[model samples]
Target: MLRSDAAGNALGAGRLKRMIRYTSLAVALVVAGCATKDDVDDLALDETPAEVMFNEALALRAAGDVEDAANKFSELDRVYPYSEFARKSLINIAYLNFKMGNHSEAIAAAERFTTLYPGNEDSAYALFIIGESYFRQIPDVGRDQAVTGKALQAMREVIQRYPDSEYTKQARQRVRATEDQLAGKEMEVGRYYLTRRNYLASINRFKVVVTNYQTTRHVEEALYRLTESYYALGVVNEAQTAAAVLGHNFPQSEWYQDAYSLLQKGGLEPQESKGSWLSRAFGNMKLL
Candidate 1:
């Protein structure tokens, strides 16, 4: 009976030790949690309010500290994403980046603003910034025209979607400018192929200008080149059709004279074929 009592006492002591260990661990966790919460509170105290931060960013921009202003605007967006000041800061960030010639960054910020607030009045401004950024990045005609295409698309969106907005006029101008650039690119490639006697490839490129970019200055040359290419390819009827269309549209243009002269070399005069693709493309348009 004495041995049994001793065993019981030893087991109770073992259980008591486990309980003390568990209590100590619980207390440690509680203290750690309090410390973490205090750290968070301290960090919150360091953060500026959204309105104050945005104003500071504007001040920085007014003082010609554009880079610093952009950083401040971004910080406001990160810290107070749902605040009204944050929304304003987003559009301002796009404008500031554009002023600094960070065109791609400007486009990204503008696109984000449009995606988040599609119906907002500022959305027009944001889309205008996107189009302007792409316009600023447009390369020369000899370079790839992918950026020019993007500019045209973006600007056209601003014009079509927000016709009454202040940006619409500029957007229309940019649209025309981008169209000219794209047409110039097509003409450059067509000229290259034509110089190499790749008549079919050249004709395809010229046809793009004639069909899709008729308003561009390059269309006169495009039509003349089309006449040259078809005649070289032994498609004399199409050549006559091309030259007839060119002469009809741009009678005083040097390109029309050149087209007429070229056709005369092959004993053909400019005569329209009613079934020509050129006729279908320009027949209904007021090209004159």
Candidate 2:
């Protein structure tokens, strides 16, 4: 019986040791679980896929999340340089900047594209878009014309360098429109001077239209104004000369008819003069 008791005690000791080991293992597993949770939290900060992150940022912009979208786009551009995705992302950057009213950044991206891909078929188009970026900022004819000049220069580059390109055709039309706008600005300034009876300055502006901007629709109005300004300044012969030029250059123009009537009141009428480009074949012409 004593031997049986000793064996029972040893077996109990072994079982107690096994139970202690099991309890220790359970505690260790709980501690590991807490550690794993901490690791998962860290992973949440860095687990974003590149494309997935990019798209998420774009989606935020489409949902009116501008600032966040810009951050993501910039990050993508930095990380994925020279990729097809990156090239596409840059264009989106331009569009996003323009949408956010950042004209300077939009123009920079457009110009950079043209420089980086000069042989690209879309280079001219990129340039044309840069011109449009400036064109959109032009205010009324009475305001500062800095943006108008910028648009004109950019469009001129597009036309002079890409004459055969379809972009040239479109750009030429814009050029004409912009020229007309600038001419209108000149007329506005001229009209202001005329309203104040500053005939000399008014005539100078009108002369610019005749000399530098003859192709504009404002030419007819300018010529008529010149005739009137000359008459107001008591320059009768100059008034007649201007009226004659107007009648010769624009026979079908209503301004010509008006100038003729004004000349009649001044004891004169616009008479035919040998001053036309065709009539200049006569001896008095400047041609050799």
TM-score of candidate 2 on Cα atoms, chains taken together: 0.65
Task: Tell me which residue pairs clash in candidate 1.
Answer: none
Give the least accurate 10-residue stretch of model 1, judged by summed lDDT: 37-46
The estimated TM-scores of all candidates read 0.82, 0.65
Off by over 4 Å in 1: 1-46, 285-288
Position 142, candidate 1: lDDT: 94
**Per-candidate local distance difference test:** 0.88, 0.75
Per-residue lDDT tens digits for candidate 2, residues 1-288, read 356888999878866754565456556666787545555433222224457767877798888988678667766665555655556566666767777878898889778777777777767777887898898898999898889989999999999878888888878888887888888988999999999999999988887777767788998898889888988898776676667777666778899888889988978865434543323322232211
Q: How accurate is candidate 2 locally (lDDT)?
A: 0.75
lDDT of 1 by residue, 73-100 (tens): 9888866777798899999999999999
Model 1: what TM-score? 0.82
